[model samples]
Every structure is written in C-alpha cells, then in structure tokens.
Target: MIKHIVMWKLLDAAQAPRFKAELDSCKGLVPGMREFEVGIRTEGMEANHDVVLNSTFDDAAALEAYVVHPHHKKVSAYLGTLRESRAVLDYST
Candidate 1:
C-alpha cells in the first residue's frame, strides 16, 4: 500500500474547515483508494499546519492516478489559493 500524507499551513487558519471540506470531496474519487481522511488542527493543539490529508492507496499506481485525477486537480487548485505552505510524505507500507 501507499500512504500519502499532506499537511498544509493556510494563509488564514480560519479557513481550515473550508480546506478540509474541499479535500473531503475527493474521498473515493478513484479506483483503489483505500482510505481518505481530512483533518483540521485542533484548537490549542501543538501543530504547525492548519489542515491535513491522510490517505492510503492500494499501490503506487493508484496513488499516481489520484494525483492526476481531474477532481483532485481542481481541489488542489482551489486549495493553492488558501495555502501558505504544504508538506507531503509518501511511502509504501
């Protein structure tokens, strides 16, 4: 399996809910998507990013397909406007 984790620092932290919603829209968007979870930083938590996307795909090919999927691209484009910085980690498990 491939784990794809992404954390984003938003330009405005208040937009975390919106960010999470946008990411949630991509759940089950492609074949082989095993799990998709979107999370907003908890209040008063020790964290650097405003939102996170923790997902798993059946394999590297599924991960690749998700990356290029049009819906994912659109969501990414919208999120780009709201993000200050992004951190990503992808690994096979």
Candidate 2:
C-alpha cells in the first residue's frame, strides 16, 4: 500500500477549516483509494501546520490518479492561495 501524508501551513489561520473541507471533498474521487482523513489543528496545539491529510492508496498509480483528479486539482489550486507552506510524504507500509 502507499501512504500519502500532507501538512499545510495556511497564510490565514482562520481558513484552516475551509482548507480541510476542501481536502475532504476529494475523498473517494478515484478507485483504489483505501482511506482518507483530514484534520485541523486544535485550539492550543503547538503546531506549525494548520491542516493535515492522511490517506492510503492501493499503489502508486492509484495515488497518482487521485492527485490528478479534477476535483483534487481544483481544491489544490484554491489551497495554493491560502497556504503559506506545504509538506508531503509518500511511502509504502
């Protein structure tokens, strides 16, 4: 399986929820998507990022399809406007 994890630091902290919602909207967008989860930072957490996504795919191809999906692209583009930084990790487990 392929695990794709991402974290984002938003330019506007208030937009964290909106960003998470946008990420959640991409769930189930393609086949072989095993799991998808989006989380927002807590009120008092010592965190650098505002949002995090933990997703699993059956393989690299499935992960690629999810990445290139139209809805994913739209959300990603919108997120680009809101995020100050992004970190991603893709690995097999």
Candidate 3:
C-alpha cells in the first residue's frame, strides 16, 4: 500500500467547513485510492497544520495516478491558495 499524507495550515475555522465538505468529496473521486481520511486540529496546536489528509493506494503508480488525476489536481490547486503552508509525505509498504 502507498501512504500519502498531507498537512495544511488553514486560514480560519470559517473556511474549514466548506473545504471539509470538499475534502470529503475527494474520497469519491479516485477509486484507486484505498483509504481517505481528513482531520482538523481541535486543540489549537500552533506548530501543526489545521487540516490533514492520510490516504492509501494500491501502489506507487496508483499514487502517481492520483496525483495527476484531474479531480485531485483541482483539489490541490484550491488548497494551494487557502493554505499558508503545506507538507506531504508519500511512502509504500
């Protein structure tokens, strides 16, 4: 399985619900994506991102395909604007 993780620094809670809906929408996009999880930090953690995603795919190719998938790209593009900072890690097991 391929593990893809991403963390994001959000602007505020006001905008989170909208994107949270969209983030949930992501799960239905790529069938190759075996698992999808989105989280919003609740403890006001300063050194961490507000939003995070952890997903698994069948393999690296499936992960790459997800990266290039049109819907995924659209989500990524939207994320690029709202997030102050972002981090990602992709690995396989």
Candidate 4:
C-alpha cells in the first residue's frame, strides 16, 4: 500500500474548515482507497500549515487515479486559490 500525506498553508486561516471539508469530499473517489483523514490545526500550536491529509491507497496507480479524478481536480483547483503553500509525501508500506 501507499501512504500519501499532504500539508497545506492557507491564504486565509479562517478558511481551514472549508479546506478540510473539501478534502473530506475526496474520500472514496477511487477504487483502491483504504483510508482517508483530514486534520485542521488546533489552537496553541505553532502551526505552519492549516490543513493536513493522511490517506492510504492500494498502490501507486490508485493514488494516480485519485489525483486525476474530476472531483479531485475541481477541489485541487479551488484549493490552489486558497492556499499559500503545499507539501506532499508518499511512500510504500
């Protein structure tokens, strides 16, 4: 399986909830998705990013399919407008 993680710094901190909701909408978008979770920064932490996503896919191809799905593309494009920075990590487990 492949574990895919992403962190995002939003242009507006107040929009974190919206971003998390959008990320949640991506759950089950592809066949091999095993897990999907989104997290928002909590108070009292020195947070560099506003949102985080931790997900697992059966393989690299499944991850690719999720990336190219129309629903994902739409959310990604919208997020591009709302984010200041983004980071991603993927590894096989």
Candidate 5:
C-alpha cells in the first residue's frame, strides 16, 4: 500500500474549508483508492499548514492514476490558486 499525504498553506487561512471541500471531491476517484480524507486545522491548534489530504492507494500505479485523473487535475488547478505553499509525502507501507 502507498500512503500519500499532502499539506497546504493557503493564501488565506479562512479558506481551509473551501480547500477541504475541493479535496473531498476526489474521494474514490480512481480504482484501488483505499482511503481519502481531508482535514483542516482545528481552532487554536498548533499547526503550520491550513489543510491536509491523507490518502492510501493499493500501490504506486494507483497513486499515479490518481495524480493524472482529470477530476483531480481540475481540483488541483483550482487549489493551486488558493495555496501559498504545498508539501507532499508518499511512502509504501
């Protein structure tokens, strides 16, 4: 399995909800997608990024498919406008 995690610092922190909504739209978007979860920083919590995407794929191929999927491309394009910085981590487990 592959664990794919992404953290984003948004241009406006208050847009975290909007960011999460966009990420959520990609849930179950491709074959072999095991899990897809989006999180926003809790109020008053210690955090550097405003939103996160925690996902699991059956394998590297599935992860790659998710990356190139059209719906994902659309969401990503929109999110690109809303983010100031992005960080990603992918590992096999």
Candidate 6:
C-alpha cells in the first residue's frame, strides 16, 4: 500500500473551508484512490500547515495513475491559484 500525504499552505487560513470543498472534489478523479481525507488546522500550532490530505492507494502504479489523471490535473491547476506553498510525501509499508 502507498500512503500519500500532502500539506498545503493557503493564502489565508480562513480560506481553508473553501479549499476543503475543492479537495473533496478530488476523490472522484482517481479510480484507484482507496480513501481520501482532508483536515483543516485551527489549533494555531506554530509549525502546522493550513490544510492536509491523507490518501491511500493500492500501490505505486495506482498512485502514479492518480498523478497523471486528467481530472486530477484540472483540480491541481485550480489549487495553484489558492496556494502559497505546498509539501508532499509518499511511502509504502
């Protein structure tokens, strides 16, 4: 299995609700995505990201399929306009 994680720094923390709605839209874009979850950070943790996503895929190829999927690309392009910075990670167990 592959665990894909993403941390997003939005233009404003207040914008997190909007971003979460958009993030949920990504679930239908990739057939291999086993699960998807998004979180908004409101605790004022100094080092916390504004938004985070957890996604699981069956394997590397399935995850790769999500990366190149057209719908995913479309959502990513929209995300660009709302983000200040982003980080990502993927690993298997």
| Model 3 C-alpha lDDT per residue in residues 1-93, reported as the tens digit of each score | 989998878766556666666777778566678999998777656646778888999888888887888887898888677777878998877
Candidate 2: worst 10 consecutive residues by lDDT? 16-25
Q: What are the Cα lDDT values of the candidates?
A: 0.95, 0.94, 0.79, 0.96, 0.96, 0.87
Q: What is the lDDT of residue 31 in candidate 5?
A: 95
Estimate candidate 6's RMSD in Å.
1.5
lDDT of 2 by residue, 1-93 (tens): 999999999999999888888888999999999999999999987888889999999999999999999889988999999989999999998
- Superposed model 2: Cα runs more than 4 Å off: none
Clashes of each: 0, 0, 0, 0, 0, 0
Task: Assess every candidate by TM-score.
Answer: 0.98, 0.97, 0.85, 0.97, 0.98, 0.88
Q: How far is 65's C-alpha from truth in model 5 (Å)?
A: 0.6
> Of 3 and 5, which scores higher on TM-score?
5
Lowest summed lDDT across 10 adjacent residues in model 3 is found at 41-50
The pairs that clash in candidate 5 are none
Model 4 residue 10 lDDT score: 91
What's the best-to-worst order under lDDT?
A: 5, 4, 1, 2, 6, 3
Report the alpha-carbon TM-score of model 3 versus the true structure: 0.85
Per-residue alpha-carbon lDDT of candidate 4 for residues 3-87, written as tens digits (9 for 90 to 100): 9999999999999999999889999999999999999999899888899999999999999999999999999999999999999
Which of the predicted structures, 3 or 4, would earn the higher TM-score when compared with the native? Answer: 4
Residue 63 Cα positional deviation in candidate 6, in Å, after optimal superposition: 0.7
Q: Which sections of candidate 5 miss by over 4 Å?
A: none
